[model samples]
Target chain A: MHELSIAQSVVEAVEKELESQPGALLRKIGLRIGELSGVDPDSLRFSWECLTRETGFEGVALVIETRAWQRRCPPCDIVFAVSDYQTVCPQCGTRETEHAGGNELDIAYLELETP
Target chain B: MTQIPMERKVLGENDRIAAALREEFHRRGIFCLNLISSPGAGKTLLLEKTLEGFAPDRRVAVLTGDIQTDNDARRLARYGFPVQQITTAGACHLDARMIERHLANWDLSTIGLLLIENVGNLVCPTSYDLGEDAKVVILSVAEGDDKPLKYPGIFHRAELLVLSKIDLLPYVPFDIAAARDNARKVNPAIEIVELSSTTGAGLDAWRAWLDRRAVH
Candidate 1:
């Protein structure tokens, strides 16, 4: 529902990052959105379109690299990705797993316009 | 193609604002809680009960958010506590700016415990931080037992899970054990308090949890 706001933030952040190169154009925006980020990539893409409809970012691409929920088994000394929010270790079947990662919501890179 | 590696958070602006709010809250010794849940999960009723339990002179305030209604604010005001309504118009979630704006004119020094009832949403509200000391997720027996698994983002991030509307557990097909197990699966350390706003059962335990922060 607030995807538009998120998309706007993305644009604003990119523009702020490119303040030194205002004349430089962007080709694509790479995003790393984890499964637990609570952001649907499709909805964000649609919102991106709505935001950049007639702007300089109109034709720029949004490449999203999605991630899975990852948990670390303490005794087993192993980190693994698990689906369905089940943190049970695949190797040890222990429930004492720590969250290793999967809440990523970062702008990975910006592909600038070709000369 | 000039590929610049820009590893930055998309919601950096909101996060910065939230961090500032957190610093201010910490400076003033204010403990704030952000409540997330799906619509009709009895967030308002639980808040109503909580306010009713507090003393009339308690230095507690509330900020309730809804997409369109001042009705919740009106309901929460009867307890004589300072309550502010954030009508987001059409936004599904409340950002830190909204909270900051609502708290702009208010006297923060007098507020020790601040409760923010977020707009009823299991998904969108999970990403936005409100500078609260903790995030409490509410799950009612009337909803699905698999909500913790389905909406793991919110469940995974929250510190406590309030299982509301438990009085109807017998009539509903929802499984309490499964619900608790699911919440634990995602968040092994999540504290849960089962209660019904109607029967007032387990309100003491809920109040006790609140007391740890307020009455400590």
Candidate 2:
């Protein structure tokens, strides 16, 4: 699956950060994975462990924060959480809803060793 | 002992390489396209038809990604074209690092159109970016028009949507308008072209798009 590659990318990202800060050992990686991001967190974490073995980020803990999709109804001006990609709001059935958030996959912060 | 929380994305490494790959492609004026679709969507068939059309003039190369079997690669190799097959062994999608690893020693200079045919899957492939100029998502009539609604992420991310197997549209209940409407609902700006590699229906528009990209 693409999770393997995403895992590989994560390993690479940690290693690159380690390169700059010499004698740095990765402690934790803070990742924000949205539900609509199309990434499975379980698979990603498993692949991360598999790919990070023998690397600087080996055994590093991953702190993943999940983000849910949010949408706003254009007509009602009501912001609500979208469980699925439905345009109509639960409060009011209208096709005037716009996507607000919940499709982000970002590495927010990294914990590294101190030299 | 308190472990310092070094929060960072592990994909940082691949991002750097991807940036480099993008720069390399841009410097050489190479227009790369990543073609993705479900299995039996006629991706390779479409490629064969398109390649045959531009074979004599355009310097085109294909890198087909699959879990096993070089059948697709072998089929394209007969045209005396450069084709590289990357068998992922079990991976469902193609990644940037895999492409980087195999592109060595190849004459990228002689290539005009670099087409990367990703393994057949709509879900997993959309998550990975292989530094392509555009991502073409192919959908056939047999796969149901509701595919766009079911998988909005792929449609939202793709630059072009090729509606293949149009020749079978009359036989099947594939509503072309609904498919286009759904895709537009997700992206609202995706370029769509309907064609059949088997019958050569509406291929000129497809060729024109390719030709336009090839020169620019």
Highest-scoring model, TM-score: 1
DockQ of 2: 0.35
DockQ of each: 0.81, 0.35
> What is the lDDT for A27 in model 2?
82
Candidate 2, residues A1-115, lDDT tens digits: the string is 5787777766666566567677666688888887667788999999888887886567888888998777777878788876545546788787666777676677777776676
Tens-digit per-residue lDDT, B1-216, candidate 2:
235444454454555677788789888888899999999999999988877876476678899999999999998887777899999999898878888988884888987678999999998888777888889999999998989878877886788899999999879999999999888767656899999999998899899888786677
Best DockQ among the predictions, by candidate number? 1
lDDT (C-alpha) at residue A59 in model 1: 88
Q: TM-score for chain A of every candidate model? A: 0.92, 0.82
- Residue B58 CA error for candidate 2 (Å)? 1.6
Span of ten consecutive residues with least summed lDDT in model 1 chain B: B207-216
Docking quality category of candidate 1 according to DockQ thresholds: high
lDDT of each candidate versus the true structure = 0.93, 0.81
Q: What is the lDDT of residue A17 in candidate 1?
A: 88
- The segments of candidate 1 whose C-alpha lies over 4 angstroms from its true place after superposition are B214-216
